[model samples]
Target: MPVPATGRLQWTDVPTPLRARLEDALDAPVTDTNTPAGGFGHQLAAALTLRGGRRVFVKAAPDADPLTAANVHEAAVLQALPPGAPAPSLLGVHRASRWTAVVIAHLDGPHPDLSPASTDAEQTWALLDKLTSSPAPAPYRAAVSATPSTAASLHGWAELAADPPADLPAAARDRLQQLAELETAWPALACGDRIVHGDLRADNMVRDHHHGVTFVDWAHATTGPACIDAASLAPQLVLAGHTPEDVADLLRDHPATATSPETTTAFLTALTGHWHRNARKPAPPGAPGLRAYQHRAAAAGLALLSHRLS
Candidate 1:
């Protein structure tokens, strides 16, 4: 039921006119193309050698229609970012027909393993802190407030307790039920209007020799509780084999991340529960890796909850 992690779209997939616009934006003929080394999206970073041997990264998405506005918003957000922020520079935005392409200065660096040594944890926290602290633009804040939370996300643990995947362990199923019951006790926490990179997994970050870290994939950017972003990071941390001590260390050093442990456990439990439910469905995108990561997070959440209940 799980799908393989499909890589990014190819340059050949671009329409003829869109390609021309891209070439015009760069003022260079695309000498060669290199597949971007990450997740499924309509994004590509090609190594383009211009007529004069200048190189830049060219990225193309679609124009402002209902389907493509997210890309436009991403470009706008990147453009508005404070100078000296580690993010890439937005070179230009061009529109042709239904397609829109945003060009950024090519970053040369190594992709650091998401799970770096403890020495690198400070840098990681700093990057997350900067991102979480940035003010959300008015339009982005409005859009996130308007978009409703996914039904599955809102009631994930309840749904899982009613009918869990056959593959999930009995202990995991029991934890789901407990989490569902616990959800009733907490008030619906208001997120207020904080800016968050809705998805900030390890694969989305690239570390430059000079610039430190630059996060890519702004498509999932949204305005929400800072905790949700912290919650999102937990799964990745667990998958990387971080211990409870590691998590505690992160929270200890970064007080803003120190949400109530019970609340964080419940939130992460629901997230993993949702992933498990989706993984069992037929032809689910990212089901394989999603299921794997869900199990890891579920295990970590159960451990935390056990400590809280004791």
Candidate 2:
């Protein structure tokens, strides 16, 4: 399933004054703009080509909201990235009464497909393999782990066991008690010292023609279990229309994830619950399609679990 850019802001939506300011921060005149797709819930996402033939990726949000801090966090982390980091370089940042934007060197690549047996899948798996070998830089290590707070976001099964949603699947609704029990152990299981991309998925990554694989969206960067990021690939592969069995085969060569079935199941349960819960909520300011995406993601998580548990 393709993630939509349904509600994210377009380059044309930016006010003229603010656009001029961004160009000023870049110390270059903006010559063209392209809104990159795969905007899960980002408020602003686009690539601005500079007068000097440079292209920079930009992500921004309305200055008054929760995402305001996240956009700033990305800029800080991007700027502080250590040598040999797998991410792009931060070029500049801008904040005003209306919004905040962070600019980084644009990665010229195509988004990797998560579907099984494709070249994109192989490339993505290979990239995750490489990420498992590289330790998070000192700056990334200091950044918070997304697992604990993310764990707090899981409310579906518990809420359903008490007050079920009308659209909840019969299988899921019937297994609420099991889900509630299984969900409790994920946070402890996810704890570790490596930097997990925390939000690993095809959308947050790209395969560069030259660099091979490059990651975007650093706001979720954190230190956690070495396999945490790799563990996420299975569910995402399912979402990309692969079966859970195919995902299992994909994991055979993935040591970071293959070594622990218990941990993976726990991770999948917690993540499924998170998406299931959030999907039922009101859409955020700029993410109309997010709930729909979450619903699909939750289904994938659930499917992956069924196969793994069987």
In terms of lDDT, the best-performing candidate is 2
For all the candidates, what are their Cα RMSDs to the real structure?
Answer: 4.2, 3.8
- Give the residue spans of candidate 2 off by over 4 A: 1-6, 12-18, 80-82, 145-155
Error (Å) of candidate 1 at residue 175 is 2.5
Candidate models: Cα lDDT each: 0.59, 0.72
Work out how many backbone clashes candidate 2 has: 0
Q: What is the lDDT of residue 49 in candidate 1?
A: 65
Query: Residue by residue across 22-125, what tens digits does model 1's lDDT show?
Result: 88777777777766565434345465566776766666644433325655666766676555555787788777767766776777676655564544445766
Task: Give a tens-digit lDDT track for model 2, residues 1-310.
Answer: 1223456676656666778899888889889988777856746688888998998898876676566677777776676556655688887887664877888888998887666556777766776677666666766655553224353344466766778788988668778888877777776676666656667778888777777677788776666666667767778888888877888666654867777767767777878888888888888655667889899888887777666665
* Candidate 2: residue 54 Cα off by (Å): 1.9
Q: How much does candidate 2 score in TM-score?
A: 0.86
TM per candidate comes to 0.79, 0.86
Cα error, residue 56 of model 2, in Å, equals 0.8
